[model samples]
Target: MRLIDSYRDKKTVDILLTQIGNINVKHKYRFMEVCGTHTMSISRFGLRTLLPENINLISGPGCPVCVTSQGEIDAIFDLVKNNDVIIATYGDLLKVPGSNGENLYMLRSIGFDVRVIYSPLDVISIAKNTGKEVVFLSIGFETTTPASAALVKQLVKENIKNVSLFVMNKTMPRVLDFIANQKEVMVDGFLCPGHVSAITGERLYEPLVKSGFACVISGFEPVDILMSVKLLMEQVNKGKFWVENNYGRVVKSNGNELAMKLMYEVFEDCDACWRGIGIIGKSGLKLRDNYKEYDAIERFNIFIDYDKSLPGCRCGDVLLGRINPTDCSFYGKRCTPDNPFGPCMVSNEGSCAAYYKFGG
Candidate 1:
């Protein structure tokens, strides 16, 4: 079978769904796919409707913008207030509301010096040409860390000091461990993200599999997703749990070693707070001490006080996989995408956005 044609093949999807229906989960097993792309794919392909009724799939704290603490957003907004410094960030983070009624994009329009860039390379170019201080709002999972790390390495190679990184780089494994240990949310298996696994490899999720939860590194194709679900169901039925790689075409045991080396060379593990999930120890990547010259937080001396969310937003519960998007009373009413009440509603990878777009 041709690789390009395999994704759209109806027969393959039907066969996998049939196999999934045949498998009997000992009890109702709830599995969570802790990746935004996975959540988007699940909804876009109508994969949930094809699955067995006994199995439940929940969206976790996968969206980086959604999981980012309000304090961090406030911190960046604080940086924006500095006239000499230009704030550069991805587009998704523009609308994520902070403690007060301020966001990056809104601050930008008010002449706060915020700019959106597609990649960190743009920031490097901007810093090199302009005489102004540029702070790259480095936010994302493993897929994006390499680019940030690469930019840092570029700065080091050229001894550029004007460019800095205000990093909120999150590790997926640590956060997954936090979710696995949660008493309230019962996740029997995980459809591990394909892009993340491509960078970190299948070996990263071995601990979760050892703890009796199946982890399948999956691609975004419809067939890849359906096959992953079927594999998870097979593991559940036999009372066996293991880390499997369905996306063998890209992911490997070691992942991208060069990228990992670059990441370790430039960044150190530090504790970071999720918006609703509180702080998870050693789950975030900060600039290493040797690379302190590129640290925006230190350069700006910006102190951000801890701030909680507004009264009625259920983004915390929604992020932890405890409830669906519609479970919130303000889901569609007060929390539409145009005027988002929470980060989950604002981010494109957010469960609320996915549900709103796909009729969940």
Candidate 2:
């Protein structure tokens, strides 16, 4: 059988759902899926409707674009308006609204040089061809860090002076730690990010497990998610807070060592800002001193002060899993995808976008 078909097999999904249902637990269980892709998959498959009423799945600050602070969005806008450099970024970032109610997409329409790049390496070609300074807006968790690091490594080796990186890359474990310790959040188990797990491995979740949270490394497929839910439910009921690997086909105990080595070599831990959720200590990655010449923040003298939360926008609470998107007054009424007021509404991986598109 093909890989996708094997994971999406109806018989397999039914069997896993049955296994999950058989684990009769009386307690109200809340499992947080920490990967945005998992959130979309859960919604896309309508997996929540099939699960028992006691098993409540919530979304976390897993969407990179959604979690990117308003201050950073403001900084990006400032960088674009005040400078002559070309902005190369992934497409999702183009629509995320800044505090000034402007986005890269709007700026591009008004004649700013904003290019949607598929990969970080594309910046090298853009810089070389245009003979103009190019700033690559690097964003994502561990899954995309290695590529950005490689881009930096290449620029340094080639002595490319026109290219710089505006890095907004964040690490996952620290944020997970923050969520697990929050007294109000009520997360019993974490359906950990599968792609991030591929880079950092199972050992990365050991600390969370030790702190008394069930951590399951899950894939995005239907069977994968259902199987993860089953494992998480069993662990929670038995009071065994262990790290479980349900997606063993890709994830490993230690993760990809080469990728980890490359990532850390170019970037180091620093405090990062999350929209709605304040600053997290050592939760973000910044370019190392050796690569300071390629740092956009330093080159441009841009400093982000604080994020501005729009009135009546409960995106922050939604990201914390304190409330569902439906609880927000503006979710479907005013905050549709085409006319987004918050970052959560703009990114496809965002919880609000998932809830809006797939229906809770």
Candidate 3:
């Protein structure tokens, strides 16, 4: 059958659902997908409604912007407010409210001089051409880190001094470890993120599998998601835990080594704070000492007094899979994309945003 025809084939979905129902899960299984894109796609396709009631899917700390600490946002604003510096960041990060009802986009509107760039490469060009101190508000997972690292390498090669990177890069493994240790939530398995797996590889998730939880790296397509759920159910029924790569076409065991090498060369693991989750050790990436010249924090001597999240925001619980979007008192009420109370509702990849956009 053609790709378009197959997607609309309800019979195919019925067969998959039937197979899923036939497989004895033995115990209740809760699988978490730690990527915001995964959450959006799953919701958009109504994947949750198709699953067995016994099987639960939860959203994790996958959205980079949503998980970014308020202190970091404050720090970015600190840099922006300085007349000597020009801030460059992704568009989605503009609306994430910081401590004191301040956001990058708001600062920009008030003449703080913030420019949104689609790619780090663009920021590099901007830095090279302008005399102003350009700080790229770098934030993302492994997928976006390589490009940021590449830009750093280019700046070093060209001996550019104006460009600096505020590295808020997060790794998936450490965050997953933190989530597994949380007693408030129980995750039986993980539908690993495809883009992140493509950078860190399937091997990186070995520890999670060894801990008796099944890990499957699946794609965003409907069939891919259904197939992953079926595979997880089969593994749970058989009393087996392993890392399975359902997205074999894009992800490999070792992943993109070149990208990994670039990341290590420029950044090192450090203790970084998540907005509501506090600090997770070795969860964040910072610029290496050798490349400190390109580090934004050091270049600007930026200091941020860590700010506590606003009251009535359950973003921390939402990110840790302990609560869903509806559980938050502010969800779809006081908080929304237009008037966000927390970063979870502000970011495009956030679970609350996904639920609001698609029908939660």
Predicted candidate 1 versus true structure: per-residue lDDT over 1-360, tens digit per residue = 787687869998888888777777456768898889888888888888777778788999989999988778877777777547888889998888877767776887877777889989898878878788988999998889989999999988888888999888898888899899998998889999988888998788988988888888888888998888788877877788888899999998889998888888888899888878888999999998888988888888978655656678888899999899999999999888888988889988999988888855
The per-prediction tally of clashing pairs is: 0, 0, 0
Q: Is candidate 2 or candidate 3 better by lDDT?
A: 2
Residues 208-296 of candidate 2 have per-residue lDDT tens digits of: 88988999999999999999998898888888888899888999888999999999999999999887789999999999999999999
- Candidate 2 minimal-lDDT segment of 10 residues: 304-313
Query: Per-residue alpha-carbon lDDT of model 3 for 1-360, expressed as tens digits?
Result: 675566446788788889888777456779999888889989898989888888899999999998987777777776777657888889889898877787887777877778889989898778867888888889999999999999989988888888888888998888898888887888888899999999999887888888888889998877778889899877777778899999898999999999999999999999888867888899999988899988888777889665656777889889999889989988899898899989889888999999888865
Candidate 3 stretches with Cα past 4 Å from truth are 1-9
TM-score of candidate 2 relative to the true fold? 0.98
TM-scores of the candidates in the order shown:
0.96, 0.98, 0.95
Select the stronger candidate by lDDT from 1 and 2.
Answer: 2
Q: Which candidate is the best by TM-score?
A: 2
Comparison by TM-score, 2 against 3, better one: 2
Could you give the candidate ranking by lDDT, starting with the highest? 2, 3, 1
Model 2: residue 225 alpha-carbon error in angstroms? 0.4
